[model samples]
Target: MALRLSLLLLLAILPCIVHPISAAANGRALAESVDAAFWLYEAWPRSQKPARARAPNGFAHHLRLGMGTPPLNSTFVFDTVGALPWAQCQPCVHCLPQEGAIYNPLKSTSFVNLTCPSAGGTGCPYNFSYGGDAFTSGYLATETLTVFGRSFKNITFGCGTLNQGYYDNVAGALGLGRGNLSVPNQLGVDTFGYCFAPRATFFFFGSPPQLVPNTIAATTPIVENPALPSGYFVRLVSVTVGPTSIDVPAASDLLIDSKSPFTFLEPATYALVREALVAQLKPLKEASSAACGAVGLDLCFEADNSTNATPPEVTLRFDGDANLMVSEYLVEMSSRRLLCLAMLPSSKGSFPVLGRRVLMGTPVIYDLAKNVISFQPVDCATFGATFAR
Candidate 1:
């Protein structure tokens, strides 16, 4: 059903392989052509299921990495909106429970506390907030970060001594945001791309390989909002539900985020989308709030009469005439006999977000140097099999 898929988007993480072109060898440049790839996995599958249906402010995707001198395997949630890469360190004042042992600085031979860059700070202290009560604070440090079999020495990362909120599954977070301290910016990666497939997503950083050669790629400009500098904003012209073209406010833009599980729209935009969808499915009775709330979703309908009912097709039209036609926004729960829309209204009726539900099975590229994002529809199963490692 659509509900499960949307929630699952907030329940998985990824594994990465760092391809180091050169590393402390023959006086050559270290990590000269550093291109990284990650193997994706569901974060909270049956075996790793949490007591709750979903985590607060869902950061479902996770990544695996090795840090320190002898190499300590660590788990991290890959967040596109987060501003810093941090891990729960030993001597923790207060930290959330996570799988595997926490990183111990004393045990690492290569660990070094970095000097604080900004004023009013003695050491390289960091405090990153991900809205609400979720926050992590610690001193910045450098370590030998390894992925797969390759290692990148002296990679800057946060050694969090204090962390709070919904991190029971991950050791910490890997920030893929646009901040200067983010992984991409710190590693000097010009381009990165994600090929999101079920169970096995692919992430390529630094000069991504050509993913969709023959397909019609939807290319859009990555608009920069001074208000939200770290977001990957795209110019959204309109959202088309079936044949109805719902015009979006010109000032409104869409954020391409990986952390969120479902898409969110402004109040007016959400109302329009919900109304348009309901009109198309008049035969089905609207589901009660209790039923939808059980799965932490909004806009659901009971589907007892219709056996072969199909969800309405939704398309996102961007400024460059790029259209992303969604095929499965309406997910049906066979047991519960309910069909639900995967999108929701923004918390503050603020900005709209394009979450992982819409981005699944799509090859999306983020060319930071060029300030563009490109995506194309493809059979991700076939793509994963071809590029499986």
Candidate 2:
């Protein structure tokens, strides 16, 4: 029910935060009490996890640790780092349960959560890495704290980033945000296994050798300079209902393909996740001319997926009570885009339409001064979609 109690509180509170202990008790558990409370970062954008299935920043911020009973205020997300230090985090395994945490309302924001056991959690120590979001893999640490009950103490948050589009030139190359150094280094994957370990990565524009040696898929989701014609894909057609979800264009859809034009994720299920990015859009602009018969199906998508575009899934007729909605965006063919989804959202339904390799691509970026263009499946690094630069 609610994804079955968020998978039973993520397997009963993820073993108190990755634990096992044996190797000489590892300096007696790091001198005594230092199990790194919590850490997770994957502010995704081009990685595709179903656009992180809701709360991917479509606006979410409701923190109330008690009054509203914050048993898990917004299902605190971001959990994927375990190559060791007691690994095994199938994306937090079951998720939902933190007391408070769930961000992703970009005007400014990209995060995963439990920065460090504050609030109802406790206190983190360390476990870092950086690099991943669309292609997968990233981290950060030094794990901060203070989440007991609002003692924010002049709040200060900064992790630069390394999981949602990788960014943290080592805090900006020693000099700190005084940035630039990177190299072929890219983003993260080597070192920082434990000392307590849960997950972390720090870069905040402060660059440096940003990890390497392979933590898992290190760096790969390029294309954003002006490269197209390859296949083009970075879309999210419809889905609305917001006071401010970045001016709002798509509007949070859920039509699912009235016929085949396509449009999904319309409140696809999200009690609370806050921020969990992932995408797979490209509808041209909703393909028309009567469903791409000729001056129509300009829709693109060739990785084998054929397309004629248009199958139905656009409902328009507003004003009466504000009843106009969408989720249609064109850019067709992954075999026409398919998605039925359901390992457990209620235990059934939605897993057909077929198509989601995380919005597959490798080179496609057209910004033209923010007209908006970005696509990357692994590499190609090109896309300039429009930014005329």
Candidate 3:
């Protein structure tokens, strides 16, 4: 099991939900190690099959990894992390605020809503899906991408395939193969035009579909998030590694995922500010009235700037380590407004989930039984590198 969480452990790991509050669970999250999922070929469950177990069969994505060692050799590691998962539990379904929405992160950070197209309403627009029945839950997938190295966490880009998607979960996608995040939707090239990140040469899923104006009106920004602690939707609210672990009270009981990414806060001016924010986490410790309201004040993650050719949007970065986390801006979905961040703990050894930030923008198909996730990035052509298992 990647990281087992027994039911009893749930209470300790998951802070039990009180009216508008999130409960705290107890227990050291079970930890185990498996070879990086992306390093393997033959999809997943099938690879686990006795058949293609010999070599990392599909390591043909060398070109997609980068233009030789120039970019690869220049690998610079930083510290930070971000979101994921699936299921049809009530907690996961939330309505995204569409217009004139007052986003008070302290009281209520965001919203969620699930409307299956077949059921007759708006399904989640983004491919970030939790478990749900096909009739109501939507789609589920576990996708894996075999890149040359672990240089980047989750490299975002538009693929001529799928509907020019977005990267929500990082290593989660790599372990899970790509497919219909929500059942009715399939992110084939026909849907998403060629994906693109301007000025940046690489788009992990390859060139994306053409850019059409997002229907979301500039004035009416729709915010999508399942910020409630109910049913099965659990917000990976914050990850504060290395810093508060010892000083914080009974902090060890918290469910710090194994192989989880670490956002190393290098001591810079930005680091100093992040240190202050660490002290103020008291209000955000739970989804209390003030915490809900404080959501809007989460300046630790984003900034408002408009130097780019396109209109502005929100982006995320380290609280104080701005210089190190700066490059992450290129892959940020928007750069003008604000984004959200949860405190994640630090990791000693780098794993796929910990090293890379965002993997595929498209949601994936995670066949638990098969133990493999496959994604058709544009075409199989982008796949390179040689794999021997």
Candidate 4:
């Protein structure tokens, strides 16, 4: 049955402050208006962690938006390398239970089912495999998506009837990758940026937020990987622990992924980093394998709450002299006494992934038009207020 129609569809959207910029600063004559912005929340709540999934930071975060004409509110985790934006829909054939109300397309007058030419004009089917047996498949459809208070018409997205994997407790994921069907591309925006803070932060589309004057910033070229088209790869020259440098070969392509919970390094490189951190934290005793392994991490420690022992500062030197400095390496696990390394050894031979832990408090700008990714450190909470001004 279709939902009841109402004249007023209340929405929570923050309108971006529209301002003009000189061509010298933007490199373009006209500045793109900020289309939409939304606050981010952890996909997995801290209080409820299954024994097998014990990482304090599940590494996944989600945002909420309204869909359809009547406006059905939905939550979706953002994926930097994924292409399709999808959410669990009604008519569950083989689907995992989601946190909130499932989107019912039949109830949305603005929803349109996309057809496939190969399927004799029938509904187009979309399938995505996330490895480790995690996958989502269903028909593709278009809907009027509402973010904050703005409405975008005819946005294509997946109406998944079959989805499974470690999706946490969210409704679905928004693909912010480089594919044509991705949210940014669909919106016809060449620039987008996001600021991740511990609590609530903003993800902006179109032109990025104006950084304060003389803000410390870094910019690096985004390399294209032909094999993995959707990924955002940057050149990593070397890694340094305090004053000591870790031996990572020059110009290693590191994928900057926001969905992954922890940074993954090659086994050999991880060993050197671990040895350096271990030597620095001699006063703190290493945690038991049971405690560390529970969270799927190799290094952990039991630390005194009042102790002055601190994790060594780690630095990533990218090509073009762009450096990312991470201060805390060992974060509190489930309990105050247990602290686990935020990074991990890559499973088998996967490429190194730069995860969300190192990105927190850093505002990242993806300027696709310029083929550059820029970084600026800011208090995200304070920066959020600037969007309205």
Which one is best on TM-score? Answer: 4
> Per-residue lDDT of 154-268 in model 4, one digit per residue for the tens?
6777888988885767678888877645677666668787776666556776665567775646789998886567789898777898668986844567788888867887777
What TM-score does model 2 achieve against the real structure? 0.19
- Report how far residue 214 has shifted in candidate 2, in Å: 34
The better candidate by lDDT, 2 or 3, is: 3
- lDDT tens digits by residue: candidate 2, 307-382: 3333233222211122222232223233444322111121134322202111222222222222222222222111
State TM-scores per candidate.
0.82, 0.19, 0.20, 0.83
Q: On residues 32-78, what C-alpha lDDT tens digit does candidate 1 reach at each position? A: 54634443333223233211112323246566778788888777776
For residue 157, give model 2's deviation from the true position in Å. 17
Q: Which of candidates 1 and 3 reaches a greater lDDT?
A: 1
Against the correct fold, how does model 3 do in TM-score?
Answer: 0.20
Q: In model 1, how large is the Cα lDDT of residue 164?
A: 91
Better of 1 and 4 by TM-score: 4
Which regions of candidate 4 fall more than 4 Å away from where they truly are?
Answer: 1-59
lDDT of 1: 0.67
- Against the unseen true structure, what C-alpha lDDT does each candidate score? 0.67, 0.21, 0.22, 0.69
For this target, which candidate reaches the highest lDDT against the unseen true structure?
Answer: 4
Pairs in steric clash, model 1: 2-331, 10-60, 12-43, 12-61, 13-61, 13-62, 14-62, 15-39, 16-38, 116-124
**Cα RMSDs, all models:** 8.4, 20.9, 20.8, 9.8
